[model samples]
Target: MEIVQIVGFGLIAAVLILVVKEQKPLYAFGIAAFAGISLFLLVIGKIDAVIAVLENLSERAGVPSIYMATILKIIGIAYIAEFGAQIVRDTGQESIAVKIEFAGKVLILVMAVPIISVIVDAVMNLLPTGG
Candidate 1:
């Protein structure tokens, strides 16, 4: 069912792109944009399902829920950032798209720093102090 929807969307997008090449470029762009968004929305549900499975597995393994949540957040950030960047690029705003990508990387780094600092502190604490 999922595969069928995906293939159908692709076919529609391709046909629209070809048709729009001559008649109405703007509408073609709109169709392409809608197609991309529709595909993303379709796959988003699968992503949620995958995350649920991951969370359940992590819980069974006694892994921290915070870790699982953080992982999912990172994935979400990447997906959104990439999607926005692509749209910007599609509209011929390459510079803006570059900035968007940069911002996304910076945001991800900011979110990751605390986890990194915690790990560093833990490792440091494990070391024996030399009097």
Candidate 2:
């Protein structure tokens, strides 16, 4: 029911944006932004459950909560960076959007370093010692 309303609202906004963009392009951008935020807000409610499941699975697997949290943060950064990049692109700033995406990728890599090290060490342990 709610999803239907959100989809309907998004469709209406998109059509209205197409109509108004020629005469009032700024207004169209505003409507698009509002719709984007509204849609994100609707999805945020479901994200909580997803997060809970991730947390539970990590605990069951004996994974450190910190690593799980880091992964979650990385996912969040990716989403926000993509959203920001898209908004920049919509404003005709392709270069700036590229920079934003690049920075996001770098940040994600930095955040994964600890997890990467842990995995590497575990794998190395699994190999028989040369000595």
Instruction: Give the per-residue lDDT of model 1 (tens digit) for 1-131.
Output: 77997998789798978888688878877887898898888888778778879999999999788877876787778889999999888778999999998888888887788678878999999999999
Which runs of model 2 end up more than 4 angstroms from their true locations? none
Candidate with maximal lDDT? 2
Clashes of 2: 0
Segments of candidate 1 deviating more than 4 angstroms: none
lDDT of 1: 0.85
User: How many steric clashes does model 1 contain?
Assistant: 0
